[model samples]
Target chain A: MVKTDGLHFQYPGGEAFDFPNIDLSAKDHLAVLGPSGVGKTTLLHLLSGILPASSGTIFIGNTEITSLDRKALDKFRGSHIGLVFQRYHFVKSLNVEENLQLRQYFPSKLKDKERREAIAERLGLKAHLKKKVTQLSQGQQQRVSIALGLIHKPKVVFADEPTSNLDDVNCERVLGLLKEEAKLCGSSLVIITHDQRVTEHFKNQVVL
Target chain B: MKLGFIAYKNMVSKPLNMVLSLLLLVLSVSLVTFVLQLSKQLNGQMDKNISPVDMVVGAKGSPLQLVLSSVLHIDSPTGNIKLNEAEQIIKHPFVDSAIPVSYGDNYRGYRILGTDPAYFERYEAVLQQGRLYKTTFELVAGSAVALKLGLKIGGKVVSSHGLAAAGGEAHDDKPYTIVGILEPSGTVVDQLLICNLKSVWDAHDHGDGTHGDEEHREDESNLGNEEGNDHTQENERHHDQGDKEHDHTPDDDEHHHEEEHDLHDEEKEITSLLVKFKNPIGLVQLPRFINENTNMQAALPGFEIQRLMGLLGSGVKTLNGIAMAILLVSGFSIFISLLKTIRERRQELALLRTYGLGTRKLLFLVLFEGLFLAFIGFLLGWVLGRLALILVSKYIEAAYGYVLQINGPEFVELLLLGATLLIAIIAVFLASTSIFKLNISKTLGDA
Candidate 1:
């Protein structure tokens, strides 16, 4: 669950640009659509606790995340939330298994072996577990990022333009998998995108 | 800990750079250690020769030269002082005991000392075999001198005219028999040949009677005529017979005692004298007394050692400063490399942040990486430094005439090395701002 009241954020050392109020709840699939420089990414950062909001209160599962300090924010983010980037952000020096193992860096109560096997099985990454992230193809690397994001069965998942480079077939397939997996885990999915393909998958959408 | 491991791995990744940094570290440390050790060794040798006597009197010149020639068997005398003048000084109420020394000859760079049996006893030189020379032209060999020159007891050796080995006249006919060997003192005494003062005087007296070899050579050349050679031959024969008579003479025999006294009165000559005071008050009192009362100067061995330390230490300090500066610059290079790495890996960092890693933890990781590099570099340097010491020990000993001990690293050096690692770690922390200010949302979008 997530909620934001009058969430205002502005880039420092530049002209100020304010974002509008936002509100969302559990099992919600929210897609934020906006042009470049309209604070589409800025809004997502405020909700996720990665960037501090200029003025507002952000409640995630009834906890005031905006008021938390840096250390607490990081712990809260890693445990309760999962993020998928437009470009997969796997560490180049680490193999796929190590990158996935990093998913356990944060606090978690899940069994390590069970979580590892489940993520690998679901993402079809079992075959390339020993390969370095740099050695993987774009599609395979994306699957590894997806596996890393959902390893802990987080309550909230944030994806920003995750399928921008995928073809229509893979894009539709990835969207379907994200929606199905989020529902199974009892998590809400928030995707930020300008693509029309994102609109077709989610009935619930927010336009900025 | 995690960051330190990664930093170590990164440093080792570039093997050439790692080797180069360690090479510089080892070289600088060895240079400092070797130079400091050499100065200590040289001062120790000087201290050994100086310890037996507390004061030295000679004709007015550098006191160090007098001490060096008279005690350490290096350098030539400033000038010979009158034996009566030396005796008068030694007879002072403050005088404890004095031994006269005469030098100007060497057996292949090993000094030959001309003094009494009391001189050897005062020096506490132990005889390894045989007995002290009781007759003229007989000698006692020092351990090193005997071993190095391949001379055994009863073997004969000739003295070179000059103090050094090069370009010296050899007194071939007056070859001395090695009657005894002195036990090693780990001092300059280990490189000297001790004999009675009369033997030295007789060698000059009967062998053309000259102080220098040139004069001895001139007399021999000028006396080459039939009558002159015959007279010299007669004198040589008489000299040998006189030596035999002196050997058989009793220690307290009045006739021989009177003859020695007559020789002392005729030639008022001595190479140098060593003096010692009864109390610590002599340090302040005697230096002033010797400096003003007579032409002779008094030098404190400890003062000269400290002066030498100061001179060498400043130069060493300058070199150490330059080394520190280079180490700092290398640390900066490490910082820059890490900073750039974090910047280029923003998406990866953001991913880790989403996994509950805090900004503080991330910054610490970078710092650990830097510290790890420095730690490894220091270890490499320490090992290499000891290896270098072993390799150059013989060469250094030969050139400076001082021995270097092979041992573990000094504590001060270890502390300095640790400080360098700490500085490098701090630099890495400063350079990690790129990751500290990272925007997870923008990085995700850019991905």
Candidate 2:
């Protein structure tokens, strides 16, 4: 579901960094384990096409997303690649259900109400559908972020620093949900975190 | 579903800020449009007021005041013009028709105009009910006057000593009988109590009983080829000067007035002579002709009305300035508010873009917020403006005895709404230029 090779980047008037190749099949779970300042965020950015790489080939499903233009790349990223940011920020004006709908709306302007309700039910977010994400508990907000990432059934889901701030028990619960939901959607899950506790759960691991 | 939802939500998020801009916008729009529509109506009314009479021949003074008093019947007369001297202009070959209007008495603040039946023709006024006056002291009430005074046929109107309805002594002579009522034509005739020239003379004649039974032929004549009856009421007072020459009509106390014409031709007076020319050439020649040849001044009603508008123009300009200032202030407030919003909400923009909203849709979201605000402001202002017009219309009807022409959703109002929205668009665009400079990754990561 995801492949990357020769992924390198150089910032204007700044230092350069070279990234390792990555390969993952459908329903695969990969943990790119590294501490802070090890180019973990940079590698994530390069794979997502958020920053143009100096040289790289990034593929999600059958499409090479690195060559896409700004407009096309945004659409490709919205429909094929989902990112779960570290902070789990939702649109402050929209509720939990609406935020999930908005994720689907990014690629196509259509919102699937039934599919959203099913997904909310599976994620234990049915009762909190109308709640603003900020109004939810820390655990609930994290769950909402996961729901947003997998709601559109993207081919590759990136969890950036997903369990970096959690305890051992909560971290296990979050990583379990991430891997399980990714498998249900046939998406390759990549967890980028500095926490050493996350690596044991994933059979596929890469040291950044 | 529509992208405008987010825009609206974002705008209303800061309720205090949004309300400040909205209130100013509404206030300016309503105040400006209210006064403008009113002036437009007043301007229309002036044209209608002057449609009948081309020129007014009256005693020398301000020509505007003369037209206002004699033609519009809203002001006191500029003294009286001698009927004998004013006759030359009335009898001139260029004159098509003439109606001599005499004003001296009032029935409850409404003027009593003593003129011939030709006055009704000049005004295009028809009798709503009852019959025209047949003899001296017979009166006809105008529609508005009758409705207000609750006049009935055969009832009498006692002449008051002054122009005011209240605080005036009643004339000692027999009260004038209400023989007819004029239809409401939205003209000067709607606010007057009308009778023949003999009615005014008889009312002012005090206790003299000789002219009561005289025929209508005794009224002033040789009024050119046209038939017109006009007389002055300077002698209507109960003083000794009026007591001597007041009885000018023929026959008994309640005379028909036909025989008194030739005998009192020099003694008869009219407040103003309403003149219509045979051709448009009279418009140029008549005013100058009367101003130069006769003691009476010839004032064009159209010209005098424009001068009156000019007199009122300064006040309207000051009001316009105030309305414009407030509008600009509102524009500034919106500009500042929107500018601040986009500046502070860079992360919001980043989130929207990450969700699949393109650069173009981002622009739309910002612009939509402004458009919705403008739409709301204009709607509220339009309603407030129309409300003001209704209130003004009521007051004008009560004070001036005429209804203003007010309508809904005028083309000008649409243009006003369109203009307000356009300004809002420009303001929002100028404020949201920072969107182009935003780096989505940096923005999202920093926040």
Candidate 3:
């Protein structure tokens, strides 16, 4: 479960943003829709503990993430929260399987090769597992990025503009895969994006 | 799976940069190690050759040349001093022992030293085979000279007139019989051929002079003959006592007695006299006294060797400073490369932070890359240093007859390695501090 209350943030010498409260159970999904410079990414950052909120209480699973110290929040985020960025940033030096292995490593979890292969197979990336991330095409890299976000089976997964650069078909396919993976893993999904096409897919929506 | 894997991947991804940095480090480290080893061996060989003698008295010339020729045998003698003039110094009451040395001959490029039996006694050389030289033409070969010349007991060797064999006038009329061989002493004595002073004076006697010079030479020759007779009487007295105590052959005693009278007419001269005084007063006043009062020049081995070392040390110290500067520049290059890499991989690092990798792990990943390069560079440098020392050792042995042990762990090398690693670590730490202030959300949003 993921919940937030009275989330507010302000940049240094910049305008402040006030976010509405959110409540989502496991397997539910939320899409934060906003134009440019509307704090949609800031919401995702606050929700995932990537940026500290000035006055807010964020609960993921049973812990209040905003109250945790930096190290504790890092640990808590690693075990409970997963992040998928828009630009598909992978450690380009590593291969597809090693990227997933790194994600599994940070939470001090066993590198379950079977689970990794299973995730790759589910994302239709079985043939590209040994290939470097830079060698993969756009669609394949997107799928690998989705697998990385869900490899640890976190309780909450926050994605930032995951399908903004895709065509209508790829955008739908990526959104469908993300929703399906989140539902399969029983994870709450919160996606912050400016795209209008993804708004119809999620019933729980927040507009800034 | 581990952070080290990421570090390895990052290093291998840019092979050119990694190799350039490593090559610079290896060159610096190997140069320093080579200098350390060479200087250490040079100092060791020099200290081993510095005998207990206090001063060297020879004809007036360079003090360094005198010490090199008399004590180390690495240079030619200044000139010959008259034996009578040197005998005055020997008769001083404060003198404990005075060993006269004449060096005008060589066999196979090894110097033949004409000295008294006390030369072997002072160096503490024990005979390996046969007895010490008892006659003028008999010789005692050092172990290295014997091995190098393939000489054994009773082997005859003719003397060359100069120190080197090339273009040297061979004294075919005089030949020396190897009566004894000395054991290895790890000193300059190991490369010498020891005989009495009469042998050197007799071999150089050509008798070509004016009538007045001939008369003076004849008078000096008569003096030499008288000294030989006195030496022979002293030996005969000792031999008669030995023959009475133990059953010894009188035939050998007669042969030595006959050989002493042969070639007895020669003008006696010596190259130098190695001196040791009984008190500290000699160290203060003797060299001054000899330089001002006598025709001979006194050369202090310690002072002359210090001058030689000062000349050599400047070159080594300059090279060492250059090597250290190159090492520092290599460290800076490492810092720049790491900083550039961090900037280029900003988005990637942000993505790692998103995946729950902490700042400390990210810092370590970069630090480990630097340390890994240093370790590889250090290993290659160590091997190159040993290889260089081996080559230098061969050259030094061929040129100077000094053996250098090339393979050993030196304390300075370990300290250099530790200092290099510390420099690398500090460089990486300074370069990777950007990771601490990395704003993951802003970076990912910009990307």
The DockQ of each candidate is 0.43, 0.49, 0.62
Comparing 2 with 3 on lDDT, the higher-scoring candidate is 3
- Candidate 3 residues lying further than 4 Å off, grouped into runs, are A167-173, A195-204, B84-88, B116-161, B169-186, B190-266, B377-388
Ten-residue stretch with the least lDDT total in model 1 chain B: B223-232
CA lDDT of every candidate:
0.68, 0.78, 0.81
Candidate 3, residue B7: Cα displacement in angstroms equals 2.5
Name the top DockQ candidate: 3
Task: Give candidate 1 misplaced runs (Cα > 4 Å).
Answer: A2-38, A54-57, A90-98, A106-132, A168-189, A195-208, B10-53, B58-61, B68-91, B99-271, B280-352, B373-396, B414-438, B443-447
Best by lDDT: 3
RMSD of 1: 7.7
Q: What is the lDDT of residue B109 in candidate 2?
A: 83
Q: Candidate 2 residues B260-320, lDDT tens each?
A: 4422666667788999999998888888978887777889998889878898888899998
A-chain TM-score in candidate 3? 0.96
Please give the distance, in angstroms, between residue B121's alpha carbon in candidate 3 and its true position after superposition.
5.2
- The sequence of per-residue lDDT tens digits that candidate 3 reaches over residues A1-208 is 8888888898878879998898888788999899988888888889899899889798987899889998888888887888887778888889999999999888666678988998898899999999999999989998998998899988989998998899999999999999999888788899999999998999999888
lDDT tens string, model 1, B1-447? 144444454456456655654455455545555554555555666676677777777666666655655666555656556567677767766666677776666777777788767676666788888889988778998777777788788998888665666556676757899999888767766778888766665444433332344544543453332222212232343345444444322233454444444443436355677666666676667767877977555666456545655887788678767766666666666666667666766777777787787887677766766666566666665666566666676674443333446666677767767776777777777788778678777776666
Error of 1 at A180 (Å): 7.6
Question: How good is the docking of model 1, by CAPRI class?
Answer: acceptable
